[model samples]
Target: MSSSAHSDVAPIVVSDVVKRFDKVTALDHVSLSVLRGETFGLIGPNGSGKTTLIRMLLGLGRPTSGNISVLGRKMPSRQVASRIGYMTQSSALYNELSIRENLAFFGTLYGLRGRRLKERIAATLSLVELAARADSPIQTLSGGMRQRVSLGCALIHEPELIFLDEPTVGIDPELRLAFWEYFAQLNQRGVTLVVSTHHLDEAARCNRLGLLRFGRLLAADSPDALRARSGQQDFEQAFLYFAQQAETAEAGEPTPAAEKEA
Candidate 1:
């Protein structure tokens, strides 16, 4: 491997990234990095700009200011686009097509063809436990099943990096576990994942996490590190603690917890 590849270069880097929507700022000078081969969770409540940031990272939208680099190249660059896979919150599959056909369509879009595409289709279907439903029309599947199909489509190209926006939404506990297991397996094989979610329990499974709120990043660190620094018992409490600290700093006041500690 080249020195750059072996070094501690992060797979995704956002430096002071900002996005605006006319009167409203969707992302406010946010910054974070997703390390190689690790699962990095973006945890926050709804309308926290998690999806907006993901869209910018994927080159779907341009940041009004700041820079973003994915896989060592500047983002929105076609050179590195093929090296990434994105699974959005909404199902993007063709509802009239069979599950297998959806995978084939996406695989082809990623430049896979002929024998390789056929093999990848079979592998991804089995990975998501949808081999039995390969021939079933997408509209026939339940919401969770359709989500799995969407995920399978993202995996069909075997990209080095994966971005999942609320991937486990509407999924049962059992299937959620299965999804995490598959994610772990992919990480072991050198794929990096950036998963955005509101589920604290799921956030705890990540190697590192970025807590976001109101278009800003409150904290970014390992779950245990965050809990320890905030003196909280869980991820949710730690997140709230950090958010409060941010608010206090912005308002030029010492946080209540900081005052108590002093």
Candidate 2:
């Protein structure tokens, strides 16, 4: 084996990963690499295994087969998990805690303390543009602000890699742009980002994208490359084209019920 293959330079890597729930295969021999400081996106229809894949990558859920590595460390290994910051699609914050308190708590849990904890809390809130609202009740913040606060909480320990699952769901277009801007800024600062979202228009912002369906990886490449492969000028059309191709290939296949949103 090549020495670099086992080396830990990049943030996330997976090889032939598979996850199953009884007879249902949530991920089927999936493979991908998230390089250090790059923005990688996972795109797929609902129930196409995006969330399950992220769970496997985060080691929150185990893969039934194959391998996954995060931050140069093999996962499902609890010892290496602290290097990854994960934000689920849902707000995982304590609803009763103020934004500042929430960040403080998570920071402390991540082994931060004293000036370090306070410094991270202050810097992250500012990074997410939520410094002024640090004292606001988590329940009182608007959907967009709440999402930003959730993002800040994730960054409290400044993990070198971040996995964001639909982090922009409730955020408006303007703030969505701002969120990507933050991702760009973070990436520039050497933070690797792995994100999955249903937003096709926003998918263009990613440096690379992987398209999955029925727990299988159909395509993985840049937006431009995927568009070229689909022979479509527009990305939305390109996604639909791939979806149609997948359906046409399956025996008695039904067109994806969620394609309407794509």
Model 1 worst lDDT window (10 residues): 253-262
* TM-scores of all candidate predictions against the true structure: 0.93, 0.90
What's model 2's TM-score?
Answer: 0.90
lDDT of 2 at 59: 82
Candidate 1 structure, TM-score to reference = 0.93
Query: 182 in model 1: Cα distance from truth in Å?
Result: 0.8
Per-residue CA lDDT of model 2 for 1-262, tens digit only, reads: 1235333565677788779899998987777777778899998878999999888888887789898877666877776666679888998888888999999999888999999898998899889888888898899988888889889877889877899999988778999999999999999988888899988888899998888888877778888988888999887788888878767666455533222111
The TM-score leader among the candidates is 1
lDDT of 2: 0.82
Model 2: lDDT of residue 128: 89
Q: Model 2, residue 35: what's the lDDT?
A: 76
How many steric overlaps does candidate 1 have?
A: 0
Q: What is the lDDT of candidate 1?
A: 0.87
